[model samples]
Target: MLLKLNPEHLLLIRTHAASTYPEECCGIILGYLANESKTVVEVIPTENAWSGETLEDNKRRRYAIAPEIMLKIQKEARDRSLHIIGIYHSHPDNPAIPSESDRIQAWQEYSYIIVSVPNGKAGELKSWHLDGDRQFQEEEIEIA
Candidate 1:
């Protein structure tokens, strides 16, 4: 699978990552899906709700999206004739790679865009797709 996005959209993710330093920020990618591909057309930022949870749920290390939020976004996407093709989240001081928790929590067939922000500076941004084998495969990000 391939993830295509505009350069400005990438910038938006980076900005969100920077603005939410020390804690992970997350958002949605609304787009159109073609054969074997998803093109990001909009970035919808969301609040990181896990930060306020118990100590076990470290804001800097983990992220959680309320099921209702996902459902609402799905409805909104469908209403706009678009799809929630993927989700993007930041990893403060970590690599732009999926953590074990991410892999386990990820929904199959959705693109997971991870951004690395080291020392409050945005570093790398990459997208992955969970396959039938229950593994994440890095997808090509065609910035058009």
Candidate 2:
């Protein structure tokens, strides 16, 4: 399914992701109500544990979605009749591309939005989808 992102929402993701640079930032993907296209409504930034100042291996730096936050997001989505479309995170010094570890850990049914923050600047935003066989495919994101 194609996800349409509002410009404001895009900015929120970019800004927050960049602000937490050198460490990972995470958030929930929320959908809109009463829209014909049913695009993403908002990008909600949540508290995340920083993986320290050192650039560790991918396995070591992977961000874990806190269970309480996950439950909260799920409840919000259900209340609004929206789905938990995706999860987003930042890659402090790397490109907005998924690492092998990311590929292995991503949920096949949800979109994974990666923000690449290189040198404290918002570098790129990329989305991915896992096919039936669990192979990753890059998806296009348009900011409206």
Considering every candidate listed, which one attains the maximal lDDT? 1
What's the lDDT for residue 120 in model 2? 82
The pairs that clash in candidate 2 are: none
lDDT (Cα, tens digit) per residue for candidate 2, span 1-144: 456788888788889888876667888887753332336877889867444455564323567677888898899889988888788888887888888877897887677888888888877888887888887788767667
Tell how far residue 95 is off in model 1, in angstroms: 0.5
Q: What is the C-alpha lDDT of each candidate?
A: 0.89, 0.77
Clashes of 1: 0
Worst 10 residues of 2 by lDDT: 30-39
**True-structure Cα RMSD, model 1:** 1.5
Instruction: Report RMSD (Å) for each prediction in the order shown.
Output: 1.5, 3.4
Off by over 4 Å in 1: 51-56
